[model samples]
Target: MSWRRALKDTARSGIAVEKKRLEPLIAVRGAAGLAIVIALSLWLFGPAAAASSAFGAFQAAIATFQRSWRPRPELAIASGTSLAVSTFLGYLTISKEPLFLALLVVWAFAAGMSWAAGPTIGLIASSNVAIMLVTVTLPTSVAQAAGHAAMMIVGGLVQAALIVLFPVRRWGAHRDALADALAAEADYARRLRHDPVASFDPQPLMEARNAAAVTPRQARRRPAELHGARGIAERIRPVLASLADPAMGVPAEGPARDRVRELLASAAALLDAAAHAIRHGEPVSTPPAALATFRTPDTGSILTGAPYRAMTRLNTLLQDVVETAGGAPQESALQGGAPKGRGELRDQPQPTRTRPRTAPHHPPRRRPTFLALIPKALKAMRSELHRGSPITRHATRVSAVAATGYILGTWLPLGHGYWAPLTSVMVMRPDFSQTYSRAVARLAGTVIGVAVATGVVQAATPGTLQSGTLAVASAALMYLLMRTGQFATQACIAAYVVFLLGMGGEEWTQTVPERVLLTLMGGFLAMLAYAVYPAWETPRLRTRLADWLAAQGPYAAAVFGSYADPSASNAPDVRGALLTARTARAAWHAAVARATAEPVRHRGLSRTAADDAEDALAQLGRVAMLLEAHLPERGATPVPPAARFADALRESTHKGAKAIRERRVPTWDAVREALDAWETEDTDKVLRNTATLVLDTLTELSEALDTAVPPMTLDGTAPEKPDGPRNPKDSATR
Candidate 1:
């Protein structure tokens, strides 16, 4: 594709993308808040004072919309305070170039460190840097600086008040996340019913899980319901994969197939209903007929095989959904009458099941005060000091690049030198893909915005009032499009910058070209810095994958050990292990996504190998979840074979992780032997079946490791070595 076509395509995609529902409201508030501040300043202080005071309003508006979600009151207060301090410091150093330069450098370092806290705080800190730079440029007295700072604080306060008065539904994001997960599950089921071999993208579900994971503690009004919905969605994924297996003999046609399709449709509808209820704060209505379709599978039919197993899993999911809807599952809904020979599939343990019934009577958590948040902010900054952390590396890179841009801006003859460093700071993101993409978009948007602004200024020759109006509109547009992605945000930001600069009595024709060139220079510097000393995700993909693989062992051991020796004391440890493994898995997925976004040549693993590894990890997670779900509540099972299988699985996973780390082949002999021995040993049907599932998943995992592990050296820099013969069986059993 030509560059023009590609750019057009990108613009179309960005414009068409859907954003969070509350985003438009936040954008409007941001614009209105700043406009109010500017209007008040103009009325009280006149044109000259209003010109300087508008900078304060601009900073406040930027701070207001910097985060993906609305800030809690504590966070908003912290942000306003930071802006005030930075603005005061800027005014203090306005007369001393050396002091100003030193302060900027120091603040850049601090801003970089703030990234460890989270994206929201990182953006706030970065905005502070930008505000300080802009504020220092305007000539002002100490009194004027204080007044401006107060005005900015007022702007932020207005935003916070609006948030309190017309608060967003606390559960909106969570409800949407759960709804998306279930929708993905429903799609996968539909695909399985038609073409078993068809590929299903797991990205949507992963994104949903990540979103759900970040639910604020205060927003979790219906914790049990949220947990139940999420659990059901996760468990259904593996069951769908099992049904897709050819050996399962799921009928290609007949009553069994029709029944399966109906069950999937009902599940999807139920999920949609639950999502609507949660989003709107209404009650969920369950249809009795829909529940009945999945309650009993026809005996002596093709449903007797894998189809029946899938139905049982579906029935379990239905029960969870019903509970999440604040209704008890009828006995019929709970009991899926399978064929006589088939054993019951156990329901996974709900994470919130242990909560007391009268928990609502407990006092609510105290809101975070500003003093309390100070320690948290400091702790977050401190945690990023480690050399190996991704955020630390990113912060260091951003600081170096921004400092270089600043030095060049000072030394060069450009009229608007600050634009160079500002561009560098804005574009230098942590990951290679985002950094590169933002650089391109920033440059492109600057060019387009300059041209458009120049045409408007020359044609209309707008005075102060018109320029101010245009600036407000542009600011509102910037905030509205900000969360969509970099491209849309850059376009709007470029226009906002153009209108904002014009309001200060700068000629648009003279300033636009200089601004564009300086922005381009800054963007190029940022991209070049990353390219030269890149922290590309591809290089660390193996390490991240290995870490995830390693975590699985402890997670499995903790869960299966509980089955062998069920104890109330072990519950916390098991839960912690599960959480650890889940976190590691999320990290690995994020790594893979980042790697994919980078240039193809930088990717160490082939697409096929990466996909296989991801699928294997996902399957293993499901099996582990299944094992965790079925653990006996109180008494010890003392199943020797089950214990042996768990040990062997743990050992094999550990060995595989080691091999990947050391760039050597892994042996799975002990794992295969343990599986074979466990199969032969006398055991209960439930234990036997679960163990068989584990072994099967392990074999697939071993195969994926075989494909993925051989492609890179210890440092993940070199090509694959030519090892002797490639045999799947031998490699897996070694």
Candidate 2:
């Protein structure tokens, strides 16, 4: 897999995590303001020493910001609550009243001991420690410590309040993202139905499919949704309990994944049928024209007599799932009566029961042999392998590298360079491109922050009204600037960090430049390391796309063959072809993101090649649909030589597409072979399959035309509809 492309995509996702998801979560947690609170506290009561007090505040603020950027809702809220409660306890202790001293000690103990339980506990303990150290070590009086505590308490309270305000807003954002994912998936599914083999990039479709399946809705709630701040935390336990394999924390091996995949496939199929019906002005409530072929396999004896009728009934049973999820009561009812043998409960039978139990008095229950379901299973497997494959290794390698570097930095001798470990985590992401941008921002932010901290301390001094105003303003600004450009954030964070530091006096001249230089050096080194072993993404994407297409070719050929010589007793089975087509569709979607990430030049070629391949796959889907419908309407006689006709056209079209992608001009031999294949195979199957091939072949021709024409740029127009009758080209030697 293309590690670099994957990294870039993941990093971009991370930025979204930080911005739309993580930042709001932090606010709800209330610990996001911890940085400002710490900065203000140290500046107010800490030692008047210029660099130490200023630098300490800056350091503490940085730590707070980093730590506060939590993702999970429970963690964020827990951290915020812990920090707020801890701040209050510390204030009470700083009051130095005899009665409150015990309370303070108990609070401090709880803070430290419970830190492992949550961010809240850790923040509380840390804040108390900060207050204790600053109050005792600094030359400040007891009153000053109390004053510091008061400011922290206010900051923490404000943070807790924001949590209530932002819940719905965050949920809305999540919902929108989910919606976009669904639409994208639907679009890809439609395209897949039209032409599965044409595009080998399936990442977008897979991501979209998963995202749609798991989208937050009032009607359908997954276990993980309970972890959200908006939902009841207790609900998480039940949701988790619902999951199978108690030890592994995933659904136990059963129909859970299968059910979900089936639902998605059914939904996609139904949507496709619905779209076609509506487009052609067919009645929406009527049986889908596309589904008739799913009832029987072209190769099987199962389609004769009563079994054939039974198969048609099963097709009707499966249709509701595609029409609407809510309208699947019929499907549910059908499955409800499905026989479960010994060791199984009677009601709500599991989907995987291999054979029906004997009623003893009646004929053996034969479960419907639905061939369409094969496509769904193959599609799911293909999807799982693609989306989960490349990134698994990539994430593992990154985690290993980061962990090793962190261990080395911590255990090895590195004086005043403790920041290296932190930088390593921040900079060395799988997505190296964004790492450089983040590093640049970090350096810039650190410098500006240090400078501002010095100014605040030297000028207004902490605990004063003017200093408090600056602190609040800085906090708000920091919030606003979080995910904007790195340099803009550099200035924002720099100002905030500096204000927190005690360099407010005329001493800023000495320390400001030094901090900036050190930060720049850290960022520079991080980027350099990324470049040394940089990964490019296009290679992996190409390999995956190629693999998917290669697998699809034989399947497409088989489907075409099935279309041909319909009366041939030993025709290839429709089930296998459908399964292969579905798998190819899933694989195609999984490669989309990786393909899109490639440069325009590469993406164009890949997409064009994929589209050409899809034309053949789509024709196969159509043939399968036709065969399924035709079997019940007529007895199991040969459907005619449609398969060979389609195959002949696709073979030439595939060659043409390859030629176009390779930038090779087509010779007359290729042109002649492309035309002659269709003429030689004359039947309805031949006509439809040949027509599909010709459409794709023309698409490849257009792609090739770009190379022939000057002033080149990628043109990704929808494949043009073929016009006029099929004009047979002269037969050329292979």
Candidate 3:
């Protein structure tokens, strides 16, 4: 990308506001917590103490707004505690500029390194750095600062208590995640009606899976309707894909294909209805025509053979989804006693739709409890401490910028030296686009926010009470507009900070010019820091791609191994491998997105190769998913030949990954040879067919990942001739 294009893109991203629904009630809950803390502080302490204390509630509220899976109260408490510690430590060094500056650098580095843990931690940590600036400069004794820090902890507890007592749309995030997954499937099914090979993004399903992994406390209170639905949705995806693909089940154009299209449309409507019902906790109200379309779908002659069976299986699963959405009848009603309104299935008279659903693919995987995950998070941070890691690079860059911005802010005669480093700390991120874009957004927002508040304060010269009131209003707006855009939220934040300073006895007229100028200097410093010491993703595309390829091998092998020995089936093991592969694939996708925005050369993978490799790998994963949907029963006869193929696949892909990293054309000789050997022996037809599909997809993956500079070997020797393709689409009917 050119510098002009990069700048334009970042500007547009910085300016864009999401068209999402305004979550006013949720914001009000957070603001109400802020309001309580402010009133209490003003009454008990003074305007200056109130200024220092309000940030605790303010930050605690912001933590609740993060899209985290942890409990809200936990998030609030953790954020507040982190801020209190930073505030106390920051105050101890305020009398000495050199000491505070060194501490700022170390703090900024830790904040940047926290990204390896997760975005939530990283965001809160970064805010702590920026908040540390203002808190340290409040001209208070160490004892007084400790009191203020204690007050911050109280703010957190108060916020947590409010959250526990006045819950708004409880389990609402989980509901939306599940609903979004269902809605995505609905859209995919509809698209398949016209384009059978149409692509689907699995992010929503991944998020749903994440949301479903609840703590022990959460599991007990979980809504009954949400229990089994996500598993059903996961299973539905591959079945939908396998049923629609022309090569797998349906004909290109015929009466049967038209029947398939009808089934697709019906499935879409049913899914959409289920999604809506689940999202709003309402009874399922599917269209009558959609229900009728499932009538005799398989029994009719319109679909036959595999397509027919797939259609039948789909109708059965659709019933399960609808039933789950509409919910079961009350226990009392089921026993022919008194009726209850909740948990009643609507439109439940279809006696023919009674086909049994398979048990959920596997029990939901257990996510670690919040307390238990800390050690793991710390381990991850430790891993990222090396020089090669982007997190480390980002940490180094941000820390340097913070120290430099602070010195320059103070030396340049700005009375509020903290504003510069604070701006730099808040705007800088781990990647190029975010760091640049947020710099632009934050500066613009601060200008507008500070100017508006400055005008009001200068005009009216509001006293302590009025200034506190105005600050609270700004904080409320900050909460309300946080998600709409960075620009809007930062605007409110700037105005809020202005009112806070006014409450703290700072003169409005003297601060306006310093605020805007220092903010600009800070933003410029952040952007410059990134440009000088960049960590571009373009160079690591090959490494990311290889990592994904390596992960995919084990996932496919696990599925194949299960078929080879049904009695020793490792469903959980396969699930774990599948999750690892998904993480690797998601990492590759994210790397590519970030790399594309960078003004750096593509180091290892060209654009065309990356796209092709991505598609081929997605197809491979989809094939594996389809096979997983129909694993053999525990006592079923095993396909012995599959075990050999699985071993060969596992070996070939691992070597191929090395070849990929060495910039050589990856060869799949082992895979091809194994396929030839398998063809010599007769096997169970379905197992043979699925195995061939897997092998063929891997071959496509090999061809899609080509490099032109030179051919090299994993051991630094010359390469051998690439293996010829033996398409499995031929062994079976195409």
Candidate 4:
């Protein structure tokens, strides 16, 4: 070969060799994973003679996986791999002696159990091992030990397969849950559109909404608030770096970042409010009045409040997610044909109603009695209880059912079967709906671990002392695995150890098929139990949205009212409002979770409504900030004509009433035209125009609801601007 060609060929060969070298490391980890499967199976299902040994290896693998997966600086996958290999090697070394093999299995079982249980398991496993060590069982001939080990190896391999194949069906269901909950929240928010200032109590309904939205997400992904914290460092670094720019000179960038940070900090405070609303069963305060000043702080100081603190953390988290997702692309126009200009509001399409204009002015006259309102309120409260929270009475009931199943499997006559024990644990876990995959993992891991254990036992010595020491080491390994958080690894290690010790001359292969059958049976039983109680997820989402929407009006009004007068400390009242917004948002999240739990149902209900509600609340918040900034200059603008104000207020009240009933908004165009004109009027004319527009709109909306008209699209006309006076609707003069 030419020299140049030789060097290139040699380099290629070197790369290939390195690649080949890494293959064994990967294989070793997989093998170790198998070892864990074997371990757990052996302990849970092994014949009395071999059970302890299998338990030891199983325990060791669990501890190793736990240590590996803990929230730390280590790469979880790598740590788990390393520990698995260490365990397999440990088994190999102990395989050579009869005493060692026996002790190894016992220790392995204990360790595996410990790892599965965590630190608490370690203490229990250790104590158990100590007792077992102090009390040795029948002495085994080398041939007898070999036979036992071989059988155990088989069992381990079978279980290993099952462990590796566990599937995640909950993820998709969770997504659906979110979508539905969002729809419900949107429905609730729609009711608040007319009530600009009436405070809507979040109460029980808000909590339901948050539960519906957030629960499914929680089940699907780690909370951004929790896992998102790490990315904060990477996020702030670039911002800080920009501030350090020589051309920029002074660190002016800090102010902008701080403001963003402050906004997030305020989020935490809002969360607190959400929690309070849930606890108190009332509408939360509005966000606008709550967060106006922080939008433009006098001193760039970190403000403290649960909402603010939460926001700060979330901001850091979101920034990290945004960065990882390749940082926010240059702010493109908002999605879905939103107007490019900043001031345009998309006019929702008006409903074409044939209802007569001469319809009586009073709302189909609600019988004005507290007794009449009581039934409506009670109904709303019930809806809130069911649909608003993610962790509902239904979830609790499910958990109880699972616990009962465990007890039944444990206490029943069939409890002695390997299947019964395994089923008790596997079936109760919320994630067990995907049985097909978990069954596969259990089988695969079992086979691999059993095969390795059989081979190790065929070449060893025979002494109790060595066996006891191996047992202790296995216990320690199990402790570590339990800490690492990988059940498969823990199970595999355990099975291998039990099988190896059982390797003696007694024929044991015959039981292999039986063990597999039992395991499958246990898993199937659990899945069946989970589906039987079937909780309805929709109510929770709807309830939460209703509760939060109820609070929006009053919150907006208070903040606007407070901002109108500077001598008054808007801070305390605004803080209270911020707390309420937080509560409402949380409820909205819960509702999303409840709605989307079922994909088919969720897709039927778009998230746009909920999004609109959130947007409206946010907009109100912006208005509060604007009013706070400009209120002193404006002075409480003159109250508009009482008729107009009364009309709007009445309309808002009707919307609130409709929302409490969980009714969808009806379509209306004449009212829409009148409202459009009112929206553009100056502050001095707002009350009158809004009132007039609201009165007409409310009458129309109530009529539309009676007919059950579904709103589909926006009116498509340009939204009226708030800066200038606009012509009043010709119909309004009537």
Q: Which model scores highest in TM-score?
A: 3
Task: Judging by lDDT against the true structure, name the best candidate.
Answer: 3
Which lDDT tens digits does candidate 4 get at residues 1-734? 23344334323332221111122222334335444544443354343333433433333333323211121111222223322332343334433445433443444333323322333333333323322321123124444334334433443343334333532222222222322322332232233222212233333333222232332214244322222212232222222222221111222234533443344344333333333332333333424422442334332233222212222333333223222222223112111111111112123221121111122111221222323433653454345344333223333333343334334434555422333334333323222222223333444444544444334444543233333334334434433333232234334443434443443222224334444455555445544544454344443444454455455444444544453454555545654665575577665765565344332233223455445444444443333322222222233333333323324333464365444345454222333444565566655442333334333433432333333323432344332212221211222333
TM-score-superior candidate, 1 or 4? 1
Give the local distance difference test score of model 2. 0.38
TM-score of each candidate structure, all chains considered together: 0.81, 0.41, 0.92, 0.36
Arrange candidates by lDDT, descending: 3, 1, 2, 4
Q: lDDT, candidate 3, residue 567?
A: 93
lDDT of 1: 0.64
Candidate with the larger lDDT of 1 and 2: 1
- lDDT tens string, model 1, 87-123? 7887898688777777778787788778776677787
Candidate 4 is scored at a TM of 0.36
lDDT of 1 at 597: 60
User: Each candidate's lDDT (Cα)?
Assistant: 0.64, 0.38, 0.81, 0.35
Which residue pairs in candidate 3 collide?
none
Counted clashes in each candidate structure: 0, 56, 0, 200
Range of the 10 consecutive residues with the lowest summed lDDT in candidate 3: 331-340
- By summed lDDT, the worst window of 10 consecutive residues in model 4 runs over 330-339
Q: Over the stretch 1-734, how does candidate 2's per-residue lDDT look in tens digits?
A: 25565446534543332333335443323324444444554455542332222323322333334423122243333333443344444444544544343543344333333333333333434344333422223224545434443443444443444444544233333333323333334454344333332222333323322222322232143222211211111111111111111111212233433322332344345444433432233333323333323421341232222222323333333343222222222333333221222221223212222111111111221221223323543444345333334322333333333333334433544322223323433443334455555665566557556765766566755543344345445655555555545555556655653443332332344436645554555455556555554444544443443344344444444545554554544233544544455565665554554445533245334555555444434433433342332232212334344454445544654564353444443222433444455556544532344344444444443443443422432353333323322211110000
User: What's the true lDDT of residue 487 in model 2?
Assistant: 55
Q: Write the per-residue lDDT of candidate 3 for residues 152-179, one digit (tens) a residue.
A: 8888888999999999888899899999
